[model samples]
Target: MADGLLVFDGYCGFCTRSVGWARALDRRGRVEMRPYQEPGVPESIGTDAATCADAVQFRGPDGVRHGGAAAVNALLDTVTGTRVPTTVYRATAGLQERVYRWVADHRGRFPGMTPYCESHPSECAAST
Candidate 1:
C-alpha cells in the first residue's frame, strides 16, 4: 500500500490531539501521522519544511504535495464522513486556504484541542 504521510507540528498540543483523531478516522490505514521534526522525513517527502511548520502537510505516493486543509481533505478522502467537506474544498479553492490558515494561526487556542498541558497541568509535571 502507498501510505500517505501526514506531517504536523509535534510540539503542538492541538496538532497532537488532532492527529490522534486523524489516526482513528483513517480506518483504511492510508495515512501515517508524522511529526515534522522527525529526521529525514521532510527531506524524503520533499515538502516545504517552512510551510509545513505553519500547517499540516501530506505527501502522497504519487509525489504530489498537498498542504493545509487541502492536505487534510485529501488525506481523509477515503475515511468515512469526509467526502462532503472534501468536495466543498475542491469546489471552492480559496476557501480551504483561508480556513486552514486561520486555524493554523490559532491552533494553540482552540477549545478541546488545546495543548494537553494546559488542561492537564498535573500530568505535565512529569514531562516538565
Candidate 2:
C-alpha cells in the first residue's frame, strides 16, 4: 500500500483544518493523517521529537521521508485546486524552505494557527 503519510500537529486548529482539506481533496485516498504529538508517531518516520517538531512530514510510496516544503510540495501533487501552485512550487524549491520557516516562526499572526505553531510550522506548506 503506497500511502501518503501526512504528519501534523494534533493540537493545532489550522493543522486540523489542513488535514480536513487533505481529506476533502484527496479523492484518491492516498494520504494518511498522523499527529506528530502522538506517542508512536515519530517512530513511524524514524525521527525524533525535536527534529519533527517544526514541520509537517510525509512518507511517500518508497518509504522515503520528506519534511518541510518538499513534503508540502508532494502533497500538492494529489490535492485539488493545488496543481497550479505545485508547478509554481517546483520552480521555486530554492525558496520554499525559507518561506516555510518564516511562516512557521510567525504563524500566530494568522488565526487557526496555534494548533501547529506555538513554536513551529507546516500546514500544507506542502500542497492542495
Which one wins on lDDT? 1
**What value does the lDDT take at residue 89 in candidate 1?**
79
Q: For each candidate in the order shown, give its overall lDDT on alpha carbons.
A: 0.72, 0.70
| Candidate 2 local lDDT, 1-128, one digit each (tens) | 43678887666677666777778878878777777776667888888665666888888666878888888877766454346756877789889989987876765565674454334335323211
RMSD of 1: 5.2
Tens digits of per-residue lDDT for model 1 on 1-128? 64678877766787889887988887888777777666555676786557668778888656687888888887777455457767877898697799778888998787545554454454332332
Models, CA RMSD each:
5.2, 7.0
Which whole-number lDDT from 0 to 100 does residue 97 have in model 2? 85
Model 1 collision count? 0
lDDT comparing candidate 1 with the true structure: 0.72
**TM-score between candidate 1 and the true structure:** 0.77
Displacement of residue 24 (Cα, Å) in model 1 is: 0.9
Return the clash pairs for model 1, or none: none
